[model samples]
Target: MSQKVREIRLDQIEANPNQPRKLFDETKIADLAASIKANGLMQPITVRPLPRKVGEQGRYMIVAGERRFRAHKHMGAETIRCLAVEMTEDEMAVKAIIENLQRADVTAMEEARAFQSMLDRGYTVAALMKELGLKSRNRVLDRVNLLRLNPEFQTLVEGGNLPPAYACEIATLPAALQVKVIRQVSTGQLKTAEQVRHAVIALREALAQDDIFAAMPAATEKEVAVVNRMEAKVEQIAALAALGFKDNECTIAKKVDPNKVKGMADKLALIRNHLLQMEHALRAAAAQGEILAA
Candidate 1:
């Protein structure tokens, strides 16, 4: 429910214990204070009234615009403008999450943790989409999966020092290897998403080989041939895919229209169909327990 805008004592408003954004940038708060001080408060902060003690007056907790509230405090303002909303704790939690998720500056890890908290409260993916105005379930799930990365790596992601592609590949490595790979990333030794992905695959293959030699039974000649063939296929596909990606940027992407190359789209479509078939075949083999490593 909504209430009219009113002036409230800065001291009377409390921070929401369930606020989704745990971290705040002090520099941004100072900037906001400067902006508010110069331009006057352009928008009133949103707040929810908390349960009051016996014979006490109304007390408020921020539901959104925490930075604005802090900005007001920083300027030593005694009272600030607010919209006093009435809501249950659950409603406040959901509202706070939606508000923060809508912000452009929300970090990937912050979004991940927020979505996880919603999932912890039994929110279905569909429900989360409706509540958060997201179009795809995969978007929410992807953010939540970022929590699986080591916190240090997640910090790099959150701080915008690491690209999401590199982080995804790093997440596939063992925790010990993840640290080393992250150092490579920080030191600029591992540049580009493709390099990181290739490094991850190389490490994974090495580990698989180690496991096979340490514990697995000896491979027959036919099994060895199959493994070699599979590796060759992967390398071929990876090389072709990399070429295709780079070509895309220089071909039609450069604003050059070539009706000269007839059936270009058709050729790509044929390749896509073949790729889909290969994927289905691999999945079917795995379902039948036939694709285990040596």
Candidate 2:
């Protein structure tokens, strides 16, 4: 239920533990505090009543507008404006995440962390896209993946020192690779986002070329053709055998050929051996591909 906006003591209000935002820019808060001092607070922050403790009576936990709360606190305003609302934990978390994501100053890393919190609570990507008004599943996935970024890169992105888009591009890479690329950006060796993109591409391609599997001999065009023909041959033989194995029309005794059975067993063993070898080679190739892409 909604309660009327009222004046609340700054000391009585508490920051929400579930608040999505972790970092608040001091300069922005100072500017906001100055604005509040000059124009007065234009909007009342949302809060929920906290259970009165022995000495901490009449306190409230912020449900939204934490930035405003901080700003008001900064200005040493004894009494501030607030609207009290009752909300469940999930509701409060959603509101906090939405409020922060909608704000211009919230960093990409913060947004990503908020999205991840919901996901950890069992929310699906499709549900998050709908709730957050994101246009695509891929976009939501991108935001969630940002949480996987290297801690140092996340700090740079959070501090507004690194371009978010470039950080996201490297977030797809392994953590070691991300640190290496970000170090180049930090050193100003890679001046522009475009330069970073080109460098990443060149690095990935170089890694791919150096892959051990890439050095391994691949199937020749003729070998590929031969493999296809062999598959067809096996299919034809299987079909023929199925036709003869009719439940009512054939019996093992009637169809028995001891020599042919022995021949078939030998061939199956050879096939299994060939398959094992192929599987090993394919596994090596897959591992190499992952490393290059990483």
Candidate 3:
């Protein structure tokens, strides 16, 4: 691509329509404007020639350094320095992704949407890793997964109140459970990514177990140690219950109907699995506490 440096009028320049970055901090822009006013622009923004935009005078579109362009406009400058490059639309899109991603100016959600945009354009995860200079496949996928989170959690990620690591774990839950985790975080109940990971796993397992209980609830109880929103307890009230043996043999108690045996066995297996999960969750929470104490 051909490239050269020159001065361009602000009115003749339009922001790139395909810019990957969506959220820009006004305070930072104002700070940039102040810096430019004091020391002149330390670096020129890059732009390419484009047709005029509707209802706006435009001869060029920004390929990079939009913040600098905004800073110049903020300072009421008539002309700003520019690095003009020639590239096709596809090349321009890739260039924008690389430029913004290389810097730390964007939020996690912005990076996610940008990665998604490129993926939608037919790029594979491996191709994206190579193109973006990212090392880990999970790293790229983790950012993209942030898109699955609700807008409220997304805003927390964007604002830096919640790190993307913890948010990714929370994103694996259903909407209501996601809100539950968020509430826990806000209340300082979950303070680490490890804790959040364990918590989400428990919530997911609890969800599956809830479905089973709802389908085959022998009895319900009002209170439990775990705060599940569903009917929290099931007690066997059958006249002749199926019993589990430690010798790996399935046995139905005397007089138990053959049709009811499978259901009883399933509930027994589910309860056993749930206990194992609860044990693991407890261990994980304890580990998190130890980590914090250390």
Best model per TM-score = 3
Candidate 1: the clashing residue pairs are none
lDDT of 2 by residue, 112-159 (tens): 888888888888888887788888786667777777787877887888
Residue-pair clash count for candidate 3: 0
TM-score of 2: 0.64
Q: lDDT of candidate 1?
A: 0.80
Candidate 3 ranges with C-alpha deviation above 4 Å: 52-58, 211-294
* Most lDDT-accurate candidate: 3
Q: Report the lDDT of model 3 for residue 33.
A: 96
Error of 3 at 199 (Å): 1.0
Model 1: residues with Cα > 4 Å off, grouped in runs: 205-294
In candidate 1, position 34 carries an lDDT of 97
Candidate 2 regions with alpha-carbon error over 4 angstroms: 53-56, 187-294
- Candidate 1 differs from the real structure by a C-alpha RMSD in angstroms, to one decimal, of 13.8
Candidates in descending lDDT order: 3, 1, 2
lDDT of 1 by residue, 65-113 (tens): 8999999999899999999998877677888888898899887777887
lDDT of 3: 0.81
